[model samples]
Target chain A: MDTDATYQAPSVDEIKTLLTERFAGKVNVTKTETRRVYATLPKEIVHEVCEYIHEKLTFEHISTVIGVDMVDYMQVVYHISNYHTGTMIELTTNLDNHDLHVQSISDIWVGGNWHERETYELFGIIFDGHPKLERLLTPDTYEFYPFRKSYKLRGQE
Target chain B: MAKDVLDIKAESAVMDTDKMWIIMGPQHPFSHGLWTLKIQVDGEIVKDAEPIVGYLHRGWEKEAEARSYPKIIPMADRLCYAASMTYTHLFCMTVEKALDIDVPEKAKYIRIVADEICRIQSHLMWLAAVGTDLGNFTVFLWCMREREFFMDLNVRLCGARMTTNYPRIGGVRNDTTELFDRDVMRCVERFEKVLMDDIVTLIDDSSVFVSRMKGVGYLTREQTVNLGITGPAMRGAGVDFDIRRDDPYDNYDKIDFDVPVMTQGDSYSRYQVRIEEMLQSCKIIRQAVQKVKALGKNAPYRLKVPSNVPAGRSTVRLEDPRGESLMYLISDGTDKPYRLKVRSPIFTNVSAAKPLVQGCRIADVPVVMAMIDMCLGETDR
Candidate 1:
């Protein structure tokens, strides 16, 4: 429990500075609250940004990966947590309607593998370099992403 | 008459060395749930494993999108029957975050007590499962016997045993009933005595039980974190991270408890972690019950929150009995949520089955996975 004393974690302000200085125009810091940082980055640079975060910032654990259908565009949210500081950074990246492909961070954090698979199955967002991106909670033979807005629930108009 | 003496050695000379896949699940007694675990084995040693879930998937996230905020509380309860209150509490907390409101002190304390009670019973259920998995009926019966008292406490609190939809958006469904604190304290004290004195001796003192769980299904701290394992399993692997203590929510910060950590990172370490956690839950329940009593009976327990959540996104993660269960809410200024993503801890934990059971015997698979405390209700959700 006293592990926090060993690692010199960066303050939230320092993280903002480090990320902005590194990515510059490619990253946008959306919101910062207590122990929480929200940012949006271009889909093209997601893999690079995540690599930087994992290696430099020491965000070890990937909490979850969520895929959302924004009607016109799709958004994939990655919640990565730093055990040292008890801080979580929520990285949101929007995927174009035509191209729903984004670079996978599974190589950096193996924990994100299943999350990416689930996201891929549910929202049809393909992780470009995922090892085995298949339907997780859905049948392999089942077609269509059930979580999309276009896939209506039973009795729904 | 010669008992197949015609070239018996020659007939047995060509042994089949090929690895074969063993599908255990969807119906196997070892699986405890509807999921399937396909393990490729070579002469009884499991080489690789893959867990196939979603048999119990009810489209929980998609269903939440169709219902109003309040209606989802009951749905959340069904996520994990053993630890139903935690899921509902998480859903409520997530909604309250999206709505940007704080619950009353009394409500928070009461929730702490309830959540702790849920944790104890859930661990007891897991203990029972471990007992049966290890082929010890006495342990199973004893644990189940102890668990009944906690179930009674649940009924006393909210007239429900499992699938307790007691937590609501603003605070909880209602105030703690009369004598709820007294009953909780009594249950906690009795449970601690029985567990430490009798139950611990039964398992820890038994050579067979200890040997079965000791050196198998080992995971390093790195593998645990890299695989996204949480709750007691992560602590067992020596990660030393507990959402309640590290990232406190509700009245968890106010209450004092220790997050037991074990560095062995074996099946036995995981088992010991859960046992210690149940005792810690008792300590938390006692303190939280006292806090609730100190707040008096007239303090507000439930708040009248607005039905419609503003257009925003809020994420809340809590220390569920199983692991760190997170609910990410996306509201669109309507009574319903735009999207509600539930990060079920078991989902991530179960994903590590391949690594967990590899190199272990076929018979050891049940005990190894039992340490994971599988509950497909939440895993598939």
Candidate 2:
């Protein structure tokens, strides 16, 4: 048998240690009130953390990737689920309102490509390194991001 | 006669070939609602496929933020019209979890019965549509004729056939009456024989249909998991993960049924799985009806949902016939939810098509998509 196969999976603390060592405490890790682990990492290290979690921890499926606009900065949250252990890892990053740039995780999971594109089209989050970063679930001629907090509804403020 | 001949000649000669883009939907008989598929095809082969959605986008999530918890129940019915009751049950169940409301045992059994009945109707509709796509017109007519019985039963139970907002937050809306129970049992008895005979005739009888679908549109187990495809689509690929069995919601743990799986992972396997699932749903409904009868109206028929719930989020997964449907509710200590995100199974299942449709023939695209049965309303919302 392979040595990697025989090795035990890393505990949650060990996973946290690896995350801290890689990002040097730039991430604000918070255990959500629920059973999920929520970590806010820098936009620069978003791809790296995703790679680490996917490769080392085997959180293979990115269940959901949503973008929330907070007027000043847009927040992108990747809800990754570990199928083996049945735990959810939420990785968050904030981008400036003027410059919304973050790395894409399509390389790790192909499912993230369309979801990230949806976020980009709905909230104007720029996902760098996405292979086919085109409009998904939106018209190509849509000029404004519909989900932004600054964008008012058709009749409402 | 000369004028008619000239008009026919003019109409035939008016074809412009700048890659004529024809809108196939938004009002076509094939489409359900206002979903338009812009197809740019060269002759019979498709060069480009674009799905234009948002025709039924009621801004459900945005509207949920403004409305009270009880008021959102009706809107949930519009999410997936075919499985409207299932969606409503999931929505109310998620809110019930955030409020820490425990549904009574009798309500749980009724909810299961209602859900199984809806599953049977959904699968029957899918079979009819699949049959129609394959030019088997008689099968479509027969399936609809059988489905009308269930629809009539639904109307008797909830006063509505398609949009039955019967399941509430704590429990169900109404108790099971003797008349409703007798109708359900009679339907189940008739459905058992008809379903078996129909599956044998419709699917097993035709060698041409089997040959056409046997190995077409195959999704390997690895690809299905990586693409996050769930429900019968994934089960047709031979993945043994059902939310009802894995995470038992609404007394599913108390019931006994086998999760049908197919290793072939093709359109044929999908058909087989759904057919087998209809039988399993019939069994579950029969058992649930027996249980409800034994319980004898002792279950609380109504639940008074709290005005204000705790400020938190809860994610609940329920197994719809399509697959595992997820509902995420975020409450801000108010009667209404701050965010109610529905991760529709059809949306993710349909996304797997871009990869599956790459090298297949153009005619197979609709068959593969129809097997998934993506509700455009759920996808846009």
For every model in order, what is the number of clashing pairs? 0, 1
Model 1, B1-381: lDDT tens digits are 788567757765776678999899889877889999999998889999999999988899999999998899899989999999999999999999988899999889989988988999999999999999999998899999999999999899899999888988778777888988888888888899999898889999999999999999999998899899988989999998899987889989888899999999999999999999998988888898899899997899989999999999999999988898998999999999999999989899999999999999998999999988999999888
Position B78, candidate 1: lDDT: 92
Candidate 2 local accuracy as lDDT? 0.77
Classified by CAPRI criteria, candidate 1 counts as: medium
Task: Tell me the spans in candidate 1 whose CA falls farther than 4 Å from its real position.
Answer: A1-8, B1-16
Tens-digit lDDT track of model 2 for B200-268: 476678987777677778888878778877789888988776777655787998999998999988888
| Model 1 error, position B152 (Å) | 0.8
Give the Å error, residue B299, model 1. Answer: 0.8
Q: Which residue runs does candidate 2 get wrong by more than 4 Å?
A: A1-42, A56-60, A70-73, A82-99, B1-50
lDDT of 2 at B334: 83
Question: Native-contact fraction for each model?
Answer: 0.60, 0.25
The local lDDT score (0 to 100) that residue A52 gets in candidate 2 is 74
Where does candidate 2 clash, by residue pair?
A: B231-B323
Clashing pairs in model 1? none
lDDT of 2 by residue, A70-104 (tens): 56677787777655444567777888877888988
